[model samples]
Target: MRPSIAIAGTSNSVMARCYAWVLSNSPDFDVVNHSRGASSSTVLPYALGKIDLSQTDFLVIDVLNNEENFVLLGQTTIEDVKNNLCSALDAAAEHGVVPIVLSFPRQNFLNRERVVHDAIKAYCRELGVVFVDMYEMVEDAVERAPVTVYKRSFFDGVAHIKRPISRLVGSRLADAIRRSFHSDRVATSDHALAFDRIEFCFPEPEAGLIERQNGFATEKIACLGVGESIGLMDSFDVVGIAFNSEMTDSVLSTDHEQVISLKGPDKAEGRELMTVILPTRFRSSRLTVTGEPGAKFEFVGYARHTDDRRARTRVARRSVLPVPEFDEQFKKDIALLAVT
Candidate 1:
């Protein structure tokens, strides 16, 4: 059977849609993508924990660009981003899947610091996982052509490359995959223990967390009126609230000096909004969520992604090349676009 490849990435990966588009055309692999636009690396560990990757062989992760955005916005730190990457790697190891970390160029490649991409490379080396650096690839491609032309024709000049460049990149990645095949290597227990395991707890409706609602009710959905509050006593990296398909604003406070303001979906329709208290790391912490005034939304069940230290890892019987190097032909094809 052909190996299966899965993607757990951010908006760039989704917007490019290069990997899946190119890989699916091949006869050697089955592809699936689990990516969300406008999301950062903080959410990947939570997502990987929820997604079923038991049948997956290779997992590609690309969130450096988004992580950089968060870092620049002062919402998170480099250390926290690295820790999130570690947690994500640990989650991938649970399924005994080979993980490839893909790093893209920063939006302002010429001016911005490469701290996040450098950190990603460092983590990939430390964890013994594959690392693909598309930043260098794009940089080299631009050198072959005028920067303005490359920016106008190929790149969105922000975060994503155009479809043509995306296809070229995707094709090169597919070629690399075809060359190396699948890896049987997984992270060691000591490696996995280096990070905290993410755990979620969904409170029961009868738990008295919130008043049960009559309409649009489920075990997981509790209703909170304006100024209503719910509390959880435990160790948690973050607390999540599944608000109804309505716009609401809430605040999450920890026993320590931490208060997180959360906003539900902007629109009054669509899926339930799952917002979390972030930039937090507290143990045995008491958490409180209070709806602000005019907060009219179903509480849904209260949930939290707590950090748990557990030691578990799979043994690797063999190893394959982790990084994918583009062939001469692939390099030539990318360069041809410069003059064409």
Candidate 2:
């Protein structure tokens, strides 16, 4: 028997041509869409009520476009989106519905959607639902063809994806849904939404350094000054460090700062993944990651930072890079950093 798939969200979800593409390509798949072209707050309740949960083997949702737009314009609060989404998920869970979630794509790489994605990610992690990390998805697509972003925008003010990107997004999501259905794995770390935790950081005192965020965090990380850096004050275990994107200038790790380099795999675009790592042992040595504009640095594993007067900054800081979610769309055979 073919698995029944139900698609729901606002225009962003339903407008992607991927839905029809998936149905037409997979002869054994049964697909139904319950999404509409308005704000999710307005459309979601109705979409949920109308969907036949009994027949839905998988219910895939596209979050962000509706919610993000609302939050950006002050039409809705992030809290309201969270509350309404959680309520919908609760009802889906009660009906034995297997939920698969996704966030819509963006060209400018806004964190507005990341807020929505994170909201759903937290709930889905608790419920063991699958989230197709859209940030990672589009990042790969953008690297392939930067113009793909335009295809993702509203077409003729219809709030729908263009034909080309629609096909791409749809086909990819279908594969992800099937794989997620079969793979019985749930992301254990808070990194499920792709935002790496700050093992240690020098945020402005009382400026705030939260690990998880649900709204527009304009200043998530303060940009470091020339020759100034942030790092572990005392030694702790560390597997790797991620140098997230939008960097116009390169960041350097001098030989003296020997935390060792745990390099990540090459991206699909053949761009080297900019990560620093060390081999299989814990060192008590301090590891400081310097920063420049256009890049966000995330240190992996437990580390420490001295939160003194220096930790506090007069200047506000935020990440120039977009949210760093896991790049799960592409599959590549690669090796991990081999440490001594």
Candidate 3:
């Protein structure tokens, strides 16, 4: 059987479908992508959770572009960047999967801030992680060329390089995977121990606690009515939720005194997955959904980290940017990516 490679990244990974296409064509490998667009390092743990690393050989990460964007918007900090990076690496280690972190080229407008990417590179060096400097590779390939070329050649005028450029990048990524085999496994001491306890919890749809509160289920999601409560049966520092797009503002309270107000997205945009931070960690707490009369909420899931800080950082969806038209040849592969 060929080795399997999984991708966890932002829009670049979703938009540049040809990269995974190129890798899948290689005789020596199989590829699966679990990338979501408009995401940052903040979503790595959630994305990585979807991958069964026991059957996967390598994980490729490309979130520096969005991470920097988050920093530029003041939604996160350098400290959070380090925590996010370490969370991805440490999670990969737990399953014995090798991780290859990629740094893609930033748009000309964002070229001024290199702090996030620099911190990532330094952290990788310190932990002996495999770091792929695709940013430098792309820059070196287009030496002495005008800057407008990136805008013209890229899909989003940023990191999402259009194919055959994406195909070329995929080929390079495959080469990097082969090269990683020669590297040593990460030593236990090399892990940034501070962010070592990253964990995700998904409540079962049929839990008795859910049924007792008049909670119902559609598909696999548990629906909680206003003033209803459900137990996750695990410790969590953050809760991920979504509500009916038409619902009015609502609030969620935990036994730990954590209360989060929920605002539904515009009816046109549909529902959105959001993260809510619990001010205090709870070992045996239950979350109760409360809102205005007739208001209801859907409890998606929760994430448990060393503290609430890691869960507080949010990366806003960037949908206003234009993306190039998809290539017909790669449409099948592109359709398979979780672009949202």
Ranking by lDDT: 1, 3, 2
Instruction: Please report, in order, the local distance difference test score of every candidate based on alpha carbons.
Output: 0.57, 0.43, 0.55
Residue range 183-230, candidate 1, lDDT tens digits = 544444435435444444455556454433322222345555554445
> For candidate 2, lDDT tens digit of each residue in 287-316?
344455553444322222112111111111
**Residue 150, candidate 2: how far off, in angstroms?**
9.8
TM-score of 2: 0.47
Candidate 3 C-alpha lDDT tens digits along 1-340: 5667888776666653467667766888877776655555655665666778777767778777766766776655666556656776665665666677777666653347588888888877766666666555444434433322333344445556555566655765676566554455433334323543445565574752232111111222456778887786555444233233233346778776767665532443333332221112344467787867876665545555555333221111111211123333233232222121
Alpha-carbon RMSD of each model: 5.6, 19.8, 9.6
lDDT of 1: 0.57
Q: 197, model 2: CA deviation in Å?
A: 30
Highest-lDDT candidate: 1
In candidate 3 the C-alpha lDDT for residue 55 amounts to: 79
Instruction: Give the better candidate number (2 or 3) by TM-score.
Output: 3
Error of 1 at 296 (Å): 5.3
